[model samples]
Target: MENKTRPEGFEQIFFADGNNLAKAHPVKQDIAKLKIALRQLHHNADLLIDAFIQRCESENVPVDCHMGCQWCCNQAVFASTHEMVVLVDYLERRFSPEVIAEVKEKARLKEEKLTELSPKEVLNTSLPCPLLRKGTCMVYPVRPMGCRIYLSSSEKSCHAKYDNPEDPTVIPKLFDFTLKAGRQLNEGFAASMRDEGLDMKEHRIEHILLKLLESPDKKNEWLQGATIHDNFPFDEV
Candidate 1:
């Protein structure tokens, strides 16, 4: 997918009125539409990655990441609430109550553990994703854009950074095309919400997860921009 054109009315969606934020109360159907649009954007990303992968293979470049290889999950998985809604909605339908409880507990613990660290510090730390089990992501269907674009050609480089993450230089080879597209769509959603006066800010997925887990009603408050993660311990969003 070369992405020569935006999805239909993407311009209208993105360029909606920012001053009219009071109008951004996205209903269930609107949110569903947003999720579908995101999925479409991700599909375009997949096409780009597939083509990129083929070219890399022609050049003898190997992407070491495969099923059951999830060392990257140990690092931070930050995302906008817009992106994360996909994960949470999917989990609610497919995950059992037991799994939901476990995930909540995990998010709470992670929130508590990382409360003292700044966002930058937290990024350098290795904390297993609460949704990763054994070596698989339970919510892979809705993994964030960051996860989608990150691919390692060398496991040694991944493990080295995993072991000593403070170095910051040891990172995987990420595709710019996918990252750019994902951000365009994700931030576009933010702008759409902001146009309606919604909370257009992004946050670490874990922090928002903790809030939603504690109170299901928080989602409405968050979308309305009436409450930030004031209850959240991390000062750095």
Candidate 2:
């Protein structure tokens, strides 16, 4: 397949991140080693995002997203299996068993509701993210690329879309260049994992997290380059 043209100044970032992640791939079946690689990936991505936001500010393209902005949190979130593993690890280490159980139940309910909807319906539906609690992401620092890249230029536009989900005309004014850069960074890392013969399929955050949290062994299987979950619906990019 022909490669898509990357945004200006992002091609080098993509190659550098991809090469670093590919080289960081653990030679053995060790989850700690894998987490280290994932942490590096997140750190690099965050730096790029921070630079992008700075550029946007200098160019007068303001980003209106702020703390307590939960409008965007009421939408579907898709993440890679690798991200889910890191999230699971974080939850287990930082949260209590009861909190984890609550998250699982929330994810379970959302998954159940989502299973009955078509892809288009799912997109138009506004369901609160399982990770969102009290108007903040429970795992903000380690949030997936999809969540990190979603920056709106106007809070009003975001509110319109959130309040009028069925109205196709009500669209959020998101920063296109930021989105492209973020997605390419993620794709570059995914490409590296693909080269290592690992499964890089993306799924709804709640769906995949529920599966991994319920069956902890699946996380190890995935780290060892095993394709385990095949029945879950693929999150539309």
Candidate 3:
């Protein structure tokens, strides 16, 4: 996840002059309420973020990120067990069998390659995401929380950091409160799932995909508290 600080006057940045605040309503009580709430919260936050960015651009502080920019796609990305449901569901319903086969191999190869690298080497590793097709996210709508909030105002900085992953100074601006709120909402989702006896541990993209590819029922089993697999999702690298 993106580690960033709220810029000075953070509240103002998010809710500047003339920006109307959003109100929330209670959810209908149901077994899948948490998942529903998670989607609602994410959707609402996405709106605020989109509005905020629009206003920022009006003031000449436009974000350099545009569609089809895949500089950040070539790196390590993670998703929680809670978010994996969204991913797996999308793949099963939307992608064809041939597409699924190709992505499974791509994800498995990434996992194997990263496992052999040292910590430093892994940090500098660059691999196209299995879901990335020609520089666009195939599952953009159902992308994880981490992917949703990873915004930047500088494309040059993105390139710099992606090229020299070891550099501390070459960085991009990320909204701290945006990331924090999204994570807290996700935490609630995970907590709810755990209460329902689900495995809510975070996992790397490839590891989770490989397991799901092997067994289609893994999600259903894990949701019911089944210890079907080992605890470690990412290797000890």
What's the lDDT for all of these models? 0.65, 0.78, 0.65
Model 1: per-residue Cα lDDT at residue 205 = 67
- Provide the global lDDT of candidate 2 against the true structure: 0.78
lDDT of 1 by residue, 97-129 (tens): 898999989888887887778767888888888
Candidates ranked by TM-score, best first? 2, 3, 1
Leading candidate by TM-score: 2
- Per-residue CA lDDT of candidate 2, range 73-150, in tens? 888777877778888888889999999899999999999998898877777878899888877899987888888889
RMSD of 3: 6.1
Comparing 1 with 2 on lDDT, the higher-scoring candidate is: 2
lDDT at residue 47 of model 1 (Cα atoms): 70
Give the top-scoring candidate (lDDT): 2
How far off is residue 33 in model 2, in Å? 1.8
Per-model TM-score, in order, reads 0.77, 0.88, 0.77
Listed per candidate, the RMSD to the true structure in angstroms reads: 6.5, 3.0, 6.1
